[model samples]
Target: MVKQERAVRTRQALVRAAAELFAAHGYARASLPAISARAGVSTGALHFHFPDKDALAGEVERVAARTVRELAGRCGRSEGSALGALVTATRQLAVTLAADPVTSAGFRLGGDPARRHRAGPLDWWQAWVRETVGRAEAAGELADGVCSEGAVVAVVAATAGFETLGSRDRDWLSRERMDRFWTLLLPCLASRPPTKEPRP
Candidate 1:
């Protein structure tokens, strides 16, 4: 049991170290030696846990994907309006990306053109938005003229834009900024009733 626990901790450390590097430096620039050094693990230990940089990155992506999936699952089960849940989820995601190097690295690494086989976090977010918005439209949460596809496009684009902008300026992920975004956007998309109180 102790051996297993130690292995798990080591693996986690390596993943976190890799995430920090990947988030700060693009995948092409992040080095395995640096990752190992950051993790405070020997190169042999890192190699034992992950065969290569791509494998380490894949693990980071997996962890990030899990975080997003959990967020989506919570929103899916929310009793509030679907649109409201989406807005909240977006804010949470932005906050996570801003504060969590692992998720941020997962997004960056997943989206890197150099990545050969890993799924992209942006694609996952876009799909979730498309599906969730469609449900909102079907539930009559949207204004009469609001096109589901159009709304999806706008929301996804805005969220992606936030991710891109937040990479350089964390202000983009601030609660105030997200609340302003939802406030301006909701009236145009929502029905007569406000979805939920804006995040403070």
Candidate 2:
């Protein structure tokens, strides 16, 4: 039990250190010694915790995925329509991507196909968008012919494209823009509300 606990603590420290270094320097530029030093661990400790750089990279993605998924859940409970939920979620993610170095760097690393072991955090987010959009359309909140799959593709592409843009000097995709996207999407999905019956 003691060994397990110590191991867990070591792993957590490594992840935190890696996140900071990777965020600051980008993944390709970060080295095991640097990460170990940042975590206050020996190089052997890093190797013990993570068999290779790929393993560490996978762990980073998992951490990022957990963070983003939590963010997505918060979006769902937020005040708004289903479309509103999606917009809120995405906008929050965008701002975080722009503001947080760890998040931004993790995603950049996840972009590499050879390195990724998980569902690709970006892909997961896109799948969420597609599912949410499909549900909203089915519920009569969006315009007809909205094309849930295509919309997912677009949202995924746009989000990544924005990420690749490195969050510098961009005016688009503000909360307002997200709202606008929703507004344009709604009319086609939602049918008119049924008229109320006459009072007796």
Candidate 3:
């Protein structure tokens, strides 16, 4: 049991170290040796946990996806309406990207030209946004004449842009900025603009 626990801790450390490097430097530049060094593990230990860089990146992406899904799920369950949940989720995602290196790396990896074929974190986030927007429309939470498709596109694009920009300046992911974005947008998207802004 102790051995298994140690192995799990080692793998977690390796993933975290890789995520930090991947977020700072794109996939093409983050080296295995550096990742192992950051984790305070030998190259041989890293190889035992992950055979190659791709495998390590894949694990990072998987962890990021899980984190996003949990965020979405919590927002969905806790909010009074779909539109409200969508707003909350978007705000939380920006905060998550800024605070969590693994998630930030996963998003960056998705857009990295080096990993062109991989589905990255944005794909999953886009899908969730689309689904949530659809639900809002179905429930009459959207304003009259507001098209769900257009709303989905706008939300996804804006949130993804924030993530990309946040990579360089974390202020882009600030709560005040996100609230400003929603302040401009929510009035148009929601049937009744929420009286109280969603807290991060």
Q: lDDT for every model?
A: 0.85, 0.70, 0.90
The TM-scores, one per candidate, come to 0.93, 0.74, 0.96
- Clashing residue pairs in candidate 3 (N, C-alpha, C atoms within 3 angstroms): none
What is the per-residue lDDT of model 2 for residues 98-134, given as tens digits with 9 covering 90 to 100?
A: 6655566567676654453456567678778888878
Worst 10 residues of 1 by lDDT: 191-200
What are the runs in model 3 whose C-alpha is more than 4 Å off? 195-197
How many pairs of residues in model 3 come into backbone collision? 0
Candidate 2 residue pairs in clash (backbone atoms < 3 Å): 140-190, 141-190, 142-188, 142-189, 142-190, 143-188, 143-189, 144-188
| Ranked by TM-score, top first | 3, 1, 2
Instruction: Using lDDT, give the best candidate's number.
Output: 3
RMSD of each: 1.6, 6.2, 1.3
Model 3 Cα lDDT, one tens digit per residue, 140-181: 889999989999999999988998899899999999899899
User: What TM-score, to 2 decimals, does candidate 1 have?
Assistant: 0.93
